[model samples]
Target: MSDYDSGDELLADINAESIVAGTKRDRSESAREVQLSKRPKVEDADFGSTGSNSNDEFVEHIAKTTLKENFGFDQFRHEQFSAIKSILRGENALVVFPTGAGKSLCYQIPAVAFEKIDAAKNGRPHLGSGITIVVSPLIALMKDQVDALLRRGIAAACIDSSKTYEQQQLTTAAIREGRLRLLYCAPERLNNEGFVESMKHVPGGIRLVAVDEAHCISEWGHSFRPDYLKVARFIQEIKAERVICLTATATPRVADDVARAFEIDKSNVFRTSPYRPNLRLLAESVSTKQDKFPKLFKFLREHPGSTLVYVTLQKQAEQLADDLKDEGFHVAAFHAGLKTELKAQIQDDFMASRIPIVVATIAFGMGIDKADIRNILHFDLSGTIEEYSQQIGRAGRDGKPGHCMFYICPEDFYLRENFARGDLPSRQSLRRLLEDLFHRDAVHTPEGDVIKLNQTTLGRTYDIRASPLAILLATLELRFGLIRAITPEYSSYQFEAMYNYYRVVKDDKSQEGKAIFSNAKKAQKWHHIDVNAAARSTGLLRADVIRKLNDYNDRGIILLKASGVENRYKILKELPSTPQEMDAITDKLYAEMETREEDALRRTQEVADLITGDACFALALAQHFGMGLPDGKTKCGHCTHCLTGARVVLPPRPAPSVDMVGIQKILDVCHVRDDPRFLARIAFGIKSPRVFELKLHTKKVLASLEDHDFSSLLREFTKACEAANFGAGTS
Candidate 1:
């Protein structure tokens, strides 16, 4: 061989050796391109920079230029400019701003700014090459954002179940080819392996990961979804370049949770005021369900404009929409059960002012961007203040005067409680099911025949039910290797043998008895092979086979799938006589259920109190979030309570007067001190709950007794009592 040929041969041998050694070359390392050099430094070139110029100055300057050149907006609202600057600096931030406060712009502008910076440094800017992944909880919101961006001539796309398989593949290709800049996806999609892999291959990598509705990540947050727990791991896996968590409602606790989830500095968190002065909060007590409709109708008739009527159930939403339509009102019903196309049409109609009133369930409003809504009416009591606030926040987005009214009936509390209970499974049922799944096994005969060995029948199985059994199947999928579970999708699974014995036996059939012998052997072979395959596929160990089989039967898998076969034997993994551990598990399950119930109840009460309280609406809301009011007073004078004389105050009062007749009348009629204060305190002069609790007919008599202001009513009442010869200790 020539010298050149020998050198080529040696190189080829080395490559072959590396391949055979199972050491695969890292694709990422191999694909690395030459890093571009930094731009040349300008010599005393201000670039329009001033003495006060900062990194943020460049960021803001770039953002403003992009806004005017791209989106055609002249200014940033509230903290939009600062937030975008923070994000561009690669600092994690939690932005708590009201709806329509331009939260999306915070992330969108920074993404554009970063892309521009890359362009200014290099000769060419790769549009949509800089990845900005937005993780939104609402599918509707994702669609809305994608559509809005596309309208702005921006390359944006969202991947959700609504897309067809071909469309998904096309979008995935678009992302890989760097044809899409902003990618919006639901949290569930983040867990998808293919989607994650596609993101890794995208050019420029993900520069920013923005989580919308970030409060959902916290257990203390009102709208807690268990799936949000996976977000941290997802960020870590993708090597999140930067994270920005945005929420309209977050208590200090929820803010902390968001910080922890995003690994953001707590000091970097920015929160806008939750209080909206334009929103007029009102609450009315309804004696019964019959009273709610009239009150709602009255409110609608009084203040008519684009409105959202939130109900708890689909049926209620539909029924109420019908009732409102009957009242000559334009209305549309929206719920999750409705067709997606229809729901979208309804939402479009509502947004376009084609439908003035959209009666909807909670599912409809998560991502709704209707800014002209003048009223938000709650058909029934909401489960929590967080939900109430979110629903009410839909209105007054345009800074116009809006009204929010709640018609509360005490019975609604029970209905909400029942709904919460329905989510939890009974401990006894779960324990029994777990006990069956944990202990099971199988044995095979020498002739490739299988003998059923378990409490469950080899041939009989049960049907799947929609109850605690679904939860059990989910637990099993996570713990054992029986099935794979996907949330908000397929909640259950079916057991099917992976291998086919018929194909194996088909080849051997020719060697069996030619006629009669062949037929008998085939029959025996079928029985043995079928049983053995079932046994092997179950993955149950030999000792616990019987119990698992029993569980399968109890769950109705055997009876439902494998009918007409019953041969089964018991195989215990270990002596199943540990009642103590079983009891502990049961206790734990019960405690969890109880905790959920308690949280639900507490949430209900808090919402109810907020609606009924006499304190300023803004202050009450701020206090709930652990924010103190500017002034120490309980009343803000800006809310309905302060505007009306119903606000309670402890002003200076006059000395006691001697009026026996009025004192006797007040004591005889009033039960609560506030009740008499409302009557005699304003007249005879008293300030107490008893006075208000009782409806004393002493307005005329008490007024005749004293001309003191309402503030001095209590002192006047005390003098009247003394004049009536009642002891100082007596009422």
Candidate 2:
């Protein structure tokens, strides 16, 4: 049986009380214990024995000791203790705590405990000679956590794109030498064959796996990352003993999805209420875009500590920060578009309290742990309730009074809805994608027929954004069971000889090895090879060429790196034959996309309802996460709804009319792309990949009608396309 089997007998055992010698219990409890004690005790060789209640005290003691010794904590909170105990007991868990609720300790403490226990048992400080792997999406967060752990005399290291190749090699050596108790990496690193192979050689194998921000694995989550879907396969491949999934903003649906993905039992799911009484939730109405500044200026003058003002667009962040600076406020704009060095400096300044106010998009607050942020002002509506909850949760983390204000306007809502609608690809594009994939060459493998896909090329050809394209492929795999995802492969590898190239080539005399080394083109000092090209030229199989390259890297003869990653999938079923059959599949996939789009728009509407409704604000937010305030209290008593008993009503603006003359001029000048959606995007000022590719952002006529409603502009562009006798297309 699998480790996570949830049968009736296991359920009975879980509910039974502990059996101790020389102890008395109630009749019912004694009967339950006797029944459970009759079952065979299965001892696990790698992990501790299952259902070993005798070790509970030891686990609790070690957890507390580690907490105090390594992290300087006197105790673990109830949620943290339960999750940590389960992990030490070799059980899977899903931990959902509010932001700033010490979720990191839940996993970090257990990682330390694993090492401490192993050291005591075998005179070595590692988990059965293996390391705990932490899958975190934030590179900065990984570095920060690793640094903090190292400061506390714990062995921890992170491997990410920010690290140099030499640094990564050093980390690899640490892993092999059993020096690292914990390893942190991004979700996409699971696709790195070299890293995975290195991990496979660990003495015992991977110990415990913790997936932070695990909600990204759920499609229902607000920030779904397709790479997270591969984590389950990664666990299976590595034969990990236990898994723990952690997140701060997962809804109940997302929580269930994550738990099922990791095989976490329902009883092992842990959560803490998101209600923080110290935060005062408030909202106000804005009549026009220009009317917001006066209110914002007034609020900033009143609340002066470190503040975060969130905007919807990157340009909006810059403009708002500039306007605030004009008012003599020390402020800076933070967004993904900023230079890396500048962003790092800005973050440092903010953390050090040098920048009192930061105007930023949603990208600013992922790993930020500032404790004294006094105010969080939303200059625009958040994308979802989860997003709002997370952003506001960043405030008042120190338990002092923090004020959160939302500026509500009809324009922001309309824009968010349009963005959700704009994300869906056209049906024609989906059909084209299906036809292209179904016609691709299939390689017969033992499991099934595998097809390789260049995601970049496919996305560009079909006008699908990367996220939507990922969702489409995932729908095919999970929803329809048409394909099973496999490890993606890089098209080529670039390597430089470790020492003298001539000496190394002369030493390797095998036919495939000589062909690979000699045929590889030399540019400067590095030799680059396209494995497929070399295979065809030498009449050798591609697998043989790659194996030789990997062998060279393994033997330290070459420093190798791979690039141009292509996704691979094994087909599970036959392809559709008739056009009608193809259309059926395409329409189902398109409907899946539509469902997600509608879900996003619904979340936007929920945020609007939260602001405009009369319910207690904090209670409403908690209820959204399938919880209530502590002590069964329904009202927070400190929110705007509780204090004022007034709802914020944002008056709607009049519908915008189309400008025929401006539209004609745009059509006349912007002839680079005939797709109606592309024209609509230009008119609505939504920048897409094709817009930059066509250099349309520089056109003065583009976005001339950006002030108008996006839906109205899209309709106008579609009519224009039809009138011009060209059928409708998409971008």
Q: Give the TM-score of candidate 2.
A: 0.81
**Which parts of model 2 are misplaced by more than 4 Å?**
1-53, 118-129, 164-166, 193-201, 442-452, 481-578, 656-683, 690-731
What would you estimate as the lDDT of candidate 1? Answer: 0.59
lDDT string, candidate 2, 466-585, tens digits: 778887887787667887665566776899888765687777888778778667898998888888778778888666776677667767878877777678888888877679989999
lDDT of each: 0.59, 0.78
RMSD score of candidate 1 (Å): 18.7
C-alpha RMSD values across all candidates: 18.7, 9.6
C-alpha-based local distance difference test score of model 2: 0.78
lDDT of 1 at 115: 66
**Candidate 1 wrong stretches, greater than 4 Å:** 1-26, 29-53, 123-129, 433-590, 628-638, 647-731
Residue-pair clashes per prediction, in order, are 52, 0
Q: Candidate 1 versus the native: TM-score?
A: 0.65
